[model samples]
Target: MFPGTEAQEETLMMELSRLVQEQVQGSSWWELRGKDCAILGLAFVALAPGFLLLRSSSLLLFSLGLLLLGVSHAAITVKGAHLSSHSSLTRSPLLNRIWAVFFIEVCGAFSADAGVQAHIKMHHAHTNVLGLGDSSTWKVPGLSRSLYLFIAPLAVPVITPLVALAQLKHQPLLSSLRTLLMVSLGLWSHFWILVHVSEFGSTLSALGCMFVTRNFFSLPYIHVNIFQHIGLSMFSPEQRPKRIYQMSHGVLNLPRNLLLDWTFGHSLISCHIEHHLFPKLSDNMCLKVKPIVSRFLALKSLPYQQDSYLSRLRLFFDQYQELMVLAPPITELVGIQ
Candidate 1:
């Protein structure tokens, strides 16, 4: 929908490239590795305090434990697992795979292989093409707005393992069994940690703590996931725009939420548009490149969509019938217009 003929598109890309080069470069190999290690180390540091606090008899101490544990979970899965899935944390595939196994499968309770395929291969590749990267994964039309946004997210901890198990049907037997074993090991080890380190009175107490801590950040997690993509321009396959236009039109950046920023990274929050344009960049790099991307898009008369999280929450609540309960109408973008 931005003004340009097909021939002008190449110039747009080149212009953007020049602008990018003028900006800061991407993360170095060593920096990415170090970044990954630092985040993992921080998660463990928080986890130690979390476990210790959980063992205290005071209600305030138990609540502190829940908060620390939630932050640790977010660090591992939201930041570590997401970056690893994109191969943004390392150059070597073996290193990326090992990191993914630990962060995505073991700590995050999802199949690493399935995550990469679903996210990078499909979602990122198909940004807002309907039924692809449209954030359809968060939809539940049957639920009312209150339940869909507020209540349903509480089941995320339970749903994650089930979804991981279900993806097994799509993989080869060896991969499935391996994923199954890793997931089981992760769940079992976490349960053991709760009982041994946290000093919960019984298996039930451990389970309850797990449920509470895991779901602590679920509301924001779900909110941020959907707010970035849903209600944006959706394209049918035949009428899809070119890559730049499509992503610009469909993707949105939410004003940074510190909790989400630390947990989910700038890729999923403040620099989402830049992340879509350059998926391989590290979170810090994405934040670094964001200004250049935004300026170039502005100069080119292309969209640089952004809105606040609460505004989006309000929008969804007001327009739930159209945005969630039914399929939004496919937008026919005039290419090279």
Candidate 2:
């Protein structure tokens, strides 16, 4: 019902911007960089004991190793790649590009350029619009919820490289080759760690170790991606609400989890509405600015979507056919021009 005029929308954004500025006071971007650096080192820290415990004969120690490996992988892919994709970690564009290639292609096993094209250019730009950022894009109607929610996620680690390679056909040959080399390097390094460092009994056993470790957190990974965006309002391009209205209505924030908060960052977790509203701000800044954003939205009588993680999970489980397997109905919406 808001966005009665273009002036109204602009006024909302201007005041919202001032509120965020007051909260941040130009909070240090370098602090974001340092956090990313620490996140990168999470791999080494986890891998040290992870592989050691994995190589031991004890089943409990091996399970612990599996968990650590999954944590490191999530830290790198979810947080590391996500931050670099947004160019949130550094002021230097060149260094940002370097980090993208390192975290996205090397550590995350995905193409950096493709990631930017998809996540930034399309997803962020057109959230909830049909054929653009619709949460339904992830649907696999062929697979039942049991397979998708439980079994299929285990294949994500295996499928990510293939998907990245398929996206490279549109890219320049040099760029594609770089993506290929980096993805291969990532796969091989994981394999090597299990084969050499863990000294698995056989090649198949080593691959099994890699698969389990890589996918240790995959269930939550897929769950988190869907929980925030799916079941929200969907709009057509022509009828999309104003930017503020669109984002506030379209995004949902889930409560924090220790592993998810650290690995996915506070942005993708508890502070998601703020993240979508100000993607340029790092998680630290997002947290800092949340109170301002929340109060402003409340005062403006605007939507600030928040729901529990389990509640969403239950809803999706109960209504998977409507929300995930089928294209959602576009909300009948009109906003300021």
Give the best candidate by lDDT: 1
Model 1, 117-219: lDDT tens per residue?
8888888888777887777888998899999999999999999999999999999999899899999998998899999988878988899888887787899
Q: Write the per-residue lDDT of candidate 2 for residues 191-279, one digit (tens) a residue.
A: 88788888887989988887777787788888888888878888888778788888888998888787788888888898889989899
TM-score of each: 0.94, 0.95
Q: Model 1 segments beyond 4 Å from truth?
A: 21-37
| Minimal lDDT window, size 10, model 1 | 24-33
**What lDDT is obtained when candidate 2 is compared to the true structure?**
0.83
lDDT of each: 0.84, 0.83
Each candidate structure's count of clashing pairs: 0, 0
